[model samples]
Target: MSEISILKDFQKRQMLFMELYKKAFPAVARYISRKGGNYEEAKDIFQDALVIYYEKLISKSFSPINNEKAYILGIAKHLWIRKLGSNVINDTIESAESEAVFAEEHLRTDKLIYLLETAGKKCMDILRAFYYEKASITEIAQQFGYSGTRSATVQKYKCIEKIRETVKEKSLAYEDFIE
Candidate 1:
C-alpha cells in the first residue's frame, strides 16, 4: 500500500477504536468499579480488549462479531479475569475498602485533571492525537491546521512542556500529600 493509503487505514482504525471506546468503555468501567477494580485497571482492560478486537477485525480471515459492544465487553471481562483471577474477589473487595483511604488523593488528581482539561485542552488534544490516536505529525498538522510537520512537532513539544509546568504547579500543592 502507498503511504497515503496506509495513513488513511490508520485513521480509519483510530476512528473505529474511538467509536468502540465511546460505546463500550463506560459499561466496562462501571462493571470494574462495582467489582472493586480501580479506574486504571478498567482502562487497561478496555484498551487490551480494543487491541484484540482491532486485530481480529484486520485479520485476513476475519469473522465479524454480531455485537461489537458486547464482544468488547466480554473480551474485557476475560482479560480482567486472566490478569487477576476470579479468585481475586477478596483482593478486589479489599481494594474497594482501601479506596476510601485514598479518596482525598483522588480528589487532588481530579483537580489536576480538571486544570489540564480546562486550561490546557488544546495541548491535551495535540498530545492525545500524538499518543492515544497514534497520529503522524503530518496528520496532526493537517488536522490541527499547523503549517507543517516541523510546526506540529514544535507545538507538540511546547504542549508537553506546558503540561509539565502545569503538573508541577499542581504537584506543589500535594507535597505533603506525597509520601
Candidate 2:
C-alpha cells in the first residue's frame, strides 16, 4: 500500500484503540489497584501494552489466533509482572533505562553535527539524507537533481570530506575540542 493508505490505516487503528482504551483501561486499573499500585502506574503499563498490541496487529506476519482484548490483557499482565521485578531481564524500571548507556563517540558526533550545520546547509542536507536518514543513492540523486547515482555518490563523498575538513579546522581553532 501507499504511504497515505498506511497512514490512514494507522489513524483508523489509533481511533479503534481509543475505544479499546476505554474498555481495557478499567480492567487494568482494577487489577493494579488490587495490588496496591496507583492509577498512574496502571496507565503507564496499559499504554505500553496497547503499543505492543498495535505493533503485533500491524505486523506482516500477524494472524488472528486470539481475540484482541484477551491478547492485550495477556501482554499487560506480563508487563505488570515485569514492572513488579519478577522478570529476570526486566527486574526493575531502572534496569531498562540503564541499558541505553551513552557512548563517548556521541560527543564527537555532536561536535561533527554542529560543525556540519554551521558550515553548509545543502551539504548538510545531502549528508544527513545519506548517513542519518539512510536514503539510497538513487533516491538522493533524484531528490537533489543529480544526473544519476554516480554523481550523487561523488557528491556524497565530497560532502563527507568537506565536513571532515571543517571538523578538523574547528578542533584546531578550539583547543578544548582537539583532545
Candidate 3:
C-alpha cells in the first residue's frame, strides 16, 4: 500500500476505535461497577478489551461482527472476571474495614466445607484435588482410577454442581440458624 493509503487506513482505524470507546464504554463501566470494581479498573479492562478486539479484527480468521458494542462488552466482562479470579479476594481482604466480616466469611467457608463433607467424601476429595491441589484432569483420572480424562472432567463438574447445590440449599438455613 502507498504511504498515503497506509496513513488513511490508520486514521480510519483510529476513528473506529474512538467511536467504539464512546459507544461501548458506558455498558462495560456499569457492569464492572456493579461487580465492585472501580472506575479506573473499568477503564483498564475496557482498554485491554479494545486491544483484544483490534487484534481479532486484524487476524486472518477475522469475521465481521454485527454488534461491535456487544462484542467489546463481552470481552471486557471476561477480562474483569479473569481479574477477579486472580486478585479480587486478596484485595477485598486487605481493604476490609473490620475483621468481623473476614471471620464470618471464614466461618461460612468452613461450614460449607463441612456440609460438602456430609454430602460425600468422594465429591469433596474430587473438588479438593482439582481446586486446592490444582491437579490436572489426567492426574485426577489416574489417581481416581477413572477410565479417562473425560470421565474425570465430568466427575469434577458434577462435584462442582453438587457444591453449588449444597451452598444454595444451606445458605438460607445457615443464615436463619445463625440469626
Estimate TM-scores for all models. Answer: 0.54, 0.43, 0.44
Q: Between prediction 1 and prediction 2, which has the larger lDDT?
A: 1
Worst 10 residues of 3 by lDDT: 91-100
lDDT of 1 by residue, 1-179 (tens): 53234435756655666667656666566556666788778778888888787767666687756567667766776677777766333334334334433432333444545656654778877876776676899999999999999999999998877766776776644322223
lDDT of 2 by residue, 29-139 (tens): 555555577767877887788778767666777775334554565577678888888864332333222221221222233453477676478887787566434579999
Full ranking by TM-score: 1, 3, 2
Candidate 3: clashing pairs of residues? none
Q: What is the C-alpha RMSD of each candidate to the true structure, in Å?
A: 8.7, 14.8, 17.0
Number of the candidate with higher TM-score, 2 or 3: 3
Q: Give lDDT per model, in order.
A: 0.66, 0.61, 0.66
lDDT of 1: 0.66
Clashes of 2: 0
Clashes of each: 0, 0, 0
